[model samples]
Target: MIMYLLMGLTAAVVSYGATWGARVVGNRLELHMPIRSRDMHSTPVSRLGGVAIFLGVLVALIVASQSFFVKDIYRHNFSPWGVLAGATLIVLVGVADDLLDIRWWVKLIGQSAAALVVAIWGVRMTIVPWVPEPIFLENEMIRIVLTAGLIVTTMNAFNFIDGLDGLAAGVAIIGGTAFFFTAYWVHRNAVLLDYSDLATLLMAVVVGSCIGFLPHNWFPSKIFMGDSGAMLIGLLFAAAGIVSTGQITSGLYDRANGISTVIPILLPFAVLFLPLLDLGLAVVRRTARGRSPWSADRGHLHHKLLDIGYSHRTAVILMYLWTAVLSFGGLAFAVFPWQPVLAADIFATLLMGLVTAWPYLRRGSDEPVA
Candidate 1:
């Protein structure tokens, strides 16, 4: 407990300091991405805020790894070096995009290459409990591909949802905190004990990064995360999920009769359902309209919220609320058994769904913004 708290504080301080430094350097360097055609911000903001977050997280990891109190936390089969290399690749690519307006294809290629590196380092998903393992490919290959795909998808999903001030950072913080508890519980349960410590450390890094950046990023934002911060956060989330699922005890598949192995894997997804769903919806909407999926537009759910009379602060808060609801709700279900927790989740989700859709449903009427 002490180790985790200390690590979290270190990460938060470093991330916050990095953001301040980035803002100064970014202004001097004029590092900014051009306003997308559909952008809602009236003025340009520095896009290099992600540099700070990346650095902060990197520093936090270094500190945690070296600390006596936490050395054992990540000394097992997990490879922090691989995670760092992957994060560096994404950060470099994102920074290039923010500064030079790199084409979408270029960014995609970079992300794929980075993901492949992580996959090759053996950080991929290979099992889906209850389902027969793929016959054609070896377990190693399956792990690499699945892990790489998750890394790429998560990186992009996070970038896609960075539409509103504080939205991405807030959600990242909430999701990270939820993962921390889940991993801690798994540790206590003695299931995947080898990886539990590392998982907790990773969660601390994420939480620190988000909390440190929130002050400057909240509504009436001074700076944006740009590709750098958003992509890094996504990668961290993906890595955490991989770590959690990878820690499952082998042969437990045969022991658990009714539930699927996907139960643990789905936890991260449930925590981040909103952003991933937004990404999926964006892809489908763009394809349906015969537009490039990468094309920027005001059709995002956040934009829709704004269009439907939500103040900027209200929209951001609403996003935060939903993120917490889903993330914590998922954690609750995971900590408890299916029957009781699932019932609670169902009731909570239904209430949230109604509230979330309320804005859209009342669009035609003269309803006041509640």
Candidate 2:
């Protein structure tokens, strides 16, 4: 526990410090993101903030590995290094997109290449998360393809939700925190599981990075995470999921700890529901209109909320509320027979719905949202 805390602190401090320096470097390099019709920010912001986030996580890993206590957490595996490799690849593409406006096809190629690296690094699905029983796969090719697909899809899901200021980072913080605690709990309780400690460390590093970067990305932001930061965090989240779900070899995983043996697998999707929905809808909508699936538009959920007259901050907060309710609620239901908690989530959803629709429900007032 002490080791985890110390390592997380190290990641946070390094991330925070790097973010401050990234701003100056970005400015000097003229890595500024100009205003676009699809964007809300009026002024250009630095796009290399992701460099700081990556540095922070890397430095923390290096520093933590130097400690004997931290070494023991990962003594059995080298999966974390694989995660770093894939994430580095994505960051390279993202930085290129941020600075040079790389084509979407080019970015897709880069993302797929990164996913392949992750798959080769052994962070892949060996067992299918199916009903009745989990079937273990012996075919390495299938596992590699499936693992790479999952990683790429998750990376895009998170990038889609990076529409509002602080949205991606804040939502990630909530999701990562939930997974981190669950990993920690499993480590303390699932005594037969050798990889629980490793899972916990991966999640801790992810959560700590978000915490360290949030201050620079909050509402009315100073520095934008841009594509570089967005895709990097997304890859981190995806890699953590891959490692936790696939790297564990314990027999106990077949047995349900609370509600299901697949909670870890389902939790990532639950927390990421909004983004996935938005991405899917965008794909369908664009295809129906004879546009490329990757075409940029203002039809995301955030865009709708803005169209309905919510201020940028209000829309972001409402999205945050929705994300928290679903994410935390799903985790609670998975881990406990908490009936009241479900009811509370439902009630909160209703309250938030009423607030979101109040302007429309009023049936008058031509004035726009102030």
Candidate 3:
């Protein structure tokens, strides 16, 4: 735990400095993103923030490699290096798209290629980790495909919700924190291991990067994460989940810890609920209108909140709240008694719903929201 915290702090410090450097370099290179019709920000901003994030992750891994506590991970597996390789590929693809406004299909191909890199390097998901019986994929090809699909889907989902300033990074911070704690807990209690593993270490680094990046990214932003940062964060987020799932074992299935076992299957989706929901709705909404599923539009959930008169910051906060409710609720179930966790989730859900609809409820439908 202490070692993971140190790595996280190291990542945060590096990311903070690198972000400022990235902004300066981006400005010098004239790499700012111009205002889009659907975008809310009025000023052009640097989109090279992904470079800083990748640097942060890379440095953190390097620091980890030097630590005796993390030596076991390096000796036993190639997953960490695979993540770095995949991140490099995706970040380059994203940087190109940010610079050239590349075609959507080309970006998808790049994203798929990045996903395949990690999957082929042994980050593939081989087991479902279900309760009654864990479903194992015997064929290596199927595992690779499944893992790649998950990575691609998550990358797109996160990109879709990156419309609001700080939205994507903020969500990653919250989700990554939830995942880190839960994964670490599982390793300590269920796996009976004292040292941190790949998933928790990755999550720690990811959360740290986001923490470092958020001050620049928050509403009334200084720089946008652009496609590069958004896709990089999404890829790392999904990779951590894939590695975490593979860590589950039958030991978690004990009757006393049934909830903990179930969490391994559900927490990944739970943490990503909002982004995935927005992605699904966007795909369906676009398809129904005879447009490409990936077409840009003002119909996203965040857009709706803006349309309903919530201030930009408020909408982002509401999204953050709901993310916390669902994700932490799942985490609580695994770590605490179910009855209390259930009560807390219900209360939090209702509070979030009320906060979301309060504008409409306070002001009659005939009047605009204050």
Give the Cα RMSD of candidate 1: 3.3
Candidate 3 C-alpha lDDT tens digits along 270-355: 89999999999999999999999978899999999988789999899988988898888888877777788889889989988888
Clashes of 2: 0
What C-alpha lDDT, on a 0 to 100 scale, does residue 169 get in candidate 3? 88
Residue-level lDDT tens digits of model 2 in 58-116: 87777766776667655667677787788888889989998888889999999999988
Please give the CA lDDT of all the candidate structures: 0.78, 0.77, 0.85
* Ranking of all candidate structures by their lDDT, best first: 3, 1, 2
Candidate 2 residue runs with Cα over 4 Å from true position: 193-196, 247-258, 338-347, 363-370
Cα lDDT of candidate 3 equals: 0.85
Least well predicted 10-residue stretch by lDDT in candidate 3: 249-258
For model 2, state the Cα shift of residue 28 in Å. 2.7
Off by over 4 Å in 3: 191-194, 250-256, 365-370
Q: Per-prediction TM-score, please?
A: 0.91, 0.91, 0.95
